[model samples]
Target: MARNLSTNTGSQAVGGRRHTVGRLVHYLLASPWRVIVMVLAGMTAVAMIVIGPKVMGEATNVLFEGLLGSMLVKMGAKPGTSKQAVVTYLQSRGQDKFARMIDSMNVQVGVGIDWGRFGTILMFVIGIYLISILVRLVQNFLMTRLVSDAVYTMRRQIEDKLDRLPLQYFDRTPRGEVMSRTTNDIDNISGTLQQILGELLFSVFSIIGAFIMMLTISPLLTLIAFIIIPVMALCAGVILKKTQPQFTRQWIRTGQVNSHVEEMFSGHMVVRAFGHQGKAEEEFEERNQELYQASFKASFFSALVTPMSTFFGNLSFVIVVIIGGVHVLNGSMSLGGLQAFTQYTRQASQPIGQLASMGTMLQSSLASCRRVFDFLDEAEEVPDIEHPDHLGQETGGKVEGHVRFDHVRFSYDPAEPLIKDLSIEAKPGQTIAIVGPTGAGKTTLVNLLMRFYEIQGGRITIDGVDTSRVTRHDLRSHFGMVLQDTWLFDGTVRDNLLYGLDEGQTIPEQTMIDGAKATHVDEFIRKLPQGYDTVLNEDSSELSQGERQLMTICRAFLSDPDILILDEATSSVDTRTELLVQQAMNTLRKGRTSFVIAHRLSTIRDADLILVVNHGSVVEQGTHDQLLERGGAYASLYNSQFTKGEED
Candidate 1:
């Protein structure tokens, strides 16, 4: 029912992180214009930041000079300080370096700190930071929107990719892993980006701005600081690199834990029925333990960044103080310059630590990114042949359902072939029933017919056109399926019945009533509180297996498919429900080509042709009477069921 609704409307994962950079680049490069504007704004903000410390240092220099000059006036120096007099006084006291620096001072011996100059410097600093803040705000706002959009589109792409992946992917991969990539991982990417977006900009620009400020203040101090900074970064980088593998393992283990939990929940009833609760719990505990280890390692390594950063920042601070103090005493550079240089060292190391620490979140996000990208990069199903619609056009918008498998071959594993050189033909409007033991590839045959799994070799054609030539959509448009495991969308009974209808396509109420009545489901459906409008979803207490099966058959009836596949549809229901739908099933099959895979030999006794399949190849093929006369595999299968029936 769910599939038909989609019809009406509409790879294995490789290495986890392969081509991650390339794919990320592709996503970003697609939006170069927006990126350029954000980058420019960020750079402007950084410039203002780097300039603030310099202006602040100038204010400190002015204040210090004023304090010294007022003291000199108090000691009875003249109103206007003479540089020569101060130099002579200092030299006599053996303070040659301080005397030399006094030669360049603009201080008046009698005056105090110039409040106007200090206030102007303060305003300049404020203006610089204000501009930086404004630019930063604009950049962050735009960046958040842009990243959100990219992740949004990434989700859509993953969704579309899900549609194109082959059935084998889902068969091989656990449901929780698939869900992790689609929901959890992608969400992690979005969340991590949001959390660090501002910090990422601030850390990077602060490091750059601080380094430039330090160089302008004291190149020698800047040199010593730069050496210590890289060592700090290097240690952080090394530890952070270790975190990547840990984080990768963490997420992988998370997927495992989710898979185990989801599986246990989905089959909890069966687990309890079989009394396997202890085993399930044990398995979950094991997976949880693995996840705990990985998470602990990632977090532990990531946490080291802060203390390591602090340690290096302090070491650099001490070195700068000693070296810069010497330069200050020599009067080669002012005390204010050394003070500014000290501030720059702090800023640089702090941001460097932040940037290094980000690797933790960044690595975790990248781990999630690798999973998502790996999913997106999975090998897609083979593309449909060009001009797929040409076949439909040739068929006059109708398919007669003449399907043939010509020497087809297939295998789940290449080393061990399953269906080898099997050939079959079903003329238009023929009912072909397939009987097979378990693991005999019975469902696989029909799956091949529907192009669910492409044949490893040979060609399957419908109405003399290659099935591979048409798009799966156009090909499947001609067919409808009812499997043993019936499915319905989480919607109303009416919704499930009309699932495969096109966007606005609708059936007349009478037409629906007639289809339901034909399937003998009308009475049961009408008995429901809401009748056909009843909601059918997970935990559908109102629905039963028999009701679900009947509804799927009704859905197939509504699809009006030229070809139909009923795989054990009647095998599971109670005898009474089977009998009710049997007449409707007969009517539905009339004049349509159908393939029925059934274990109940009695059910397919009247098929136009029956193929007895064992170990993936047909052991016998003939009508009921002919196969019975031969007394081979078919006769053995029939006799066992018949004897079982008589004994019952």
Candidate 2:
């Protein structure tokens, strides 16, 4: 049976709307010099883009004027013809004020056109475009490095933050949710920054630059183009408002899906054994469907912007063409000016559409960012005392392992105190056995001893010094623990055995071998193909349950802690393997003050003291023989186990 673990499901509070935006802005501006460089380069790029169309229009005008002058020369005009002759020639053709007004060039008498000027204008336009491309390349390079560095910093901060978070946080929060925030959320923010930063800059500059250029070309046509701006803004705003919430929901659903998948995969064996595969699949499908709906809604709404903008753009184009044509014929606008205005109209509308699309992405990224920042800002464990007491070096033989609980009080929830006025003592070299039914707060006693959880009232002391006065690291260093659930990372057997040793602390190879031999780990390692050098992958499925238990026992032996905690350490092994492990543990417990929480009555018969815990209180405390003689809870529990064993 699994113990009931406590969980906290309260939502974390994040910054308000203004604060969230401000935080994102702070990350964007983290590297001031890089931002400055990107800005300058981006502005240069936009300037070239804004000016390119007008330059091309100038090229068109030059070609038109040269062609008209050449036509007049062909029609019996004199060489070195002045502007008057051109005006008169156009008037002869019944041309209106618009044509005469647009023709600003002085007439040149030549049989052929001025191909040199046309080439120069075309080259100028090409040069501007090339410069724009180069500047944009620089901007992109700087922005990429900037975003990379910011994300790297954020990831590092998260890594460090995890170290400082209290164990209680992990106790309640699902591991998969934490992982999603650390990985997926950060990835979303990184990608969004990479894309949105450049697009946002270009879009803003394009809209502003295009509008100004359009005004210069012809105010009447600029006004005609302006009519579409408000309409486009309204349409895009409505679409964005609809999509933003969908984007938020999409990312939220993404996290749920990731968490569900992780949970199912981790428990896949159990699911299959219990024939719960259909139930797991159903749960996953539910999450997946929610994600699909959110994604579709976000995508559909965002997709509407491009075509809608295009529609408005085309409408403006038709209107401009009709109005500008009449102005050109009336000599109030040139054909070149009308063409430049048309391009400006498209340029202006393009950014509006881009803004709409980017709005969806930004909302998603902001949602992710909010989650990340909220996690980073969570309250850390209380700070250690300013002047912490130090337990003398265990190797120096100064640790006595005299642990005591003085009227300690605690509860997972404040309204229901689990352990009230609990007090116990273990003298040096005493083996204290804790026996209790499931959920009797047996493990909670070990948690209090190690200070894994704090007591709400009273104190726990080790060797006459209050445990709370010492650093948790120093306090925990005095004890070695082996739990029912074995934890082994992916490493060689040698590495796992040596994991407890502090950095820069070397243990003799002979000592490691002796510890392995004492725990019977050597018996199996020697039978393996690689002896002790064999690698263990995650989950260490390559090893049998007995073999893994032996390895953990070996780890505790290698640490040589002054105090040991074996919490149902041998409960999962077979009967023969348990006997062998029990013999090893008996040897390991000779000189240490040990706390054993066990369900098997046979394991604790020789303990110096047996604590019968019921409902978080020690209902009986005495030697095993004394407790049985009393015919209390301990005796009843012992007799039931004995009777069940005999019956079997």
- How does residue 454 of candidate 2 score in lDDT? 83
Which pairs in model 2 have colliding backbones?
A: 98-330, 98-331
lDDT of 2 by residue, 585-632 (tens): 999998999999999988888999999998889999999889988999
Q: Model 1, range 45-116, lDDT digits (tens) per residue?
A: 988987777778889889988987888777677877576787788889898887766665665677889999
TM per model? Answer: 0.92, 0.92
Alpha-carbon local distance difference test for all models? 0.84, 0.84
For candidate 2, the lDDT comes to 0.84
